[model samples]
Target: EKVAVVKEEVRSAAYKANVVKAERDALRLSLSVQETTQKKQVEQLQTLIEVAKAGNQDYSISNEESIKQTLNVSEQLNEQAHAEMQEMRAKIARLEANASSEIQNLEQKVKVVEAVLVGEVPAKRMRRRVKTKMKAAGV
Candidate 1:
């Protein structure tokens, strides 16, 4: 009976671990996809910029200022896109770290629960006390 219980607990731990790993992998894959898309967009922008520069040599006197203004707008857009990409990457890093921490805590709780069920001294209580604390604070 004891061996059966241990085996079940180990299986549960393995399942939870796999879930955590899968979640992390999914997030990483999403970041990779976003990065690839951003890279293509940047490359396209550079090609367009080069094309405009090439066309500038044939510009008329009256159209020169208009062309310059258009170039300025394109430059601004490129800068904004770059800035937004940086911001998004930063957010992804933070979210990945938070998810990793949560997964670790969950694994620890599972270990504690397994230990307690096997009549061992639990290293830490597995109960989620946060809900009680939140209710007390009227959250």
Candidate 2:
């Protein structure tokens, strides 16, 4: 009878030890899963930070390029406008010169007509022709 009782007690102790060992293994596995998940999350956050920094740099570079292009276009427009203004001034000066020459020609014609009418030059034949035409026209 004592031998049989000893065998039963040893079996019970072994079973309880086995249960404790299983619980410890399950806790160790849970901790390992949590640690790995946290590591992955940290790495992902780090990658996002780097990407945001790169994007910010790209934005600044693009802005600089945009400003440069705008200035270049503005300068080109200004140069074209200046050239057009100079061309217009030249055209106006030519027109004024032509008008002055036309006025001088008209003034000379007026002077010749006055000299012909006033009988002050050596034009006796022109005076006799005008008198004959006036008499024929009944003026």
Question: In TM-score terms, which candidate is top?
Answer: 1
Instruction: List the global CA lDDT of all models.
Output: 0.57, 0.54
lDDT of 1 by residue, 1-139 (tens): 5335545555665665566667657666766676576666656666665676677776465554565566566666666666766676676666656666655544454454445456564233423453343344332
- Tens digits of per-residue lDDT for model 2, 36-86: 665565555555555655767555656555555655665665566556656
TM per model?
0.48, 0.46
Q: Assess the local accuracy of residue 67 in candidate 1 as a C-alpha lDDT between 0 and 100.
A: 53
**How well does candidate 1 score on lDDT at residue 60?**
61
Clash pairs detected, candidate 1: none
Q: RMSD in Å for candidate 1, one decimal?
A: 8.3
Off by over 4 Å in 2: 1-59, 123-139
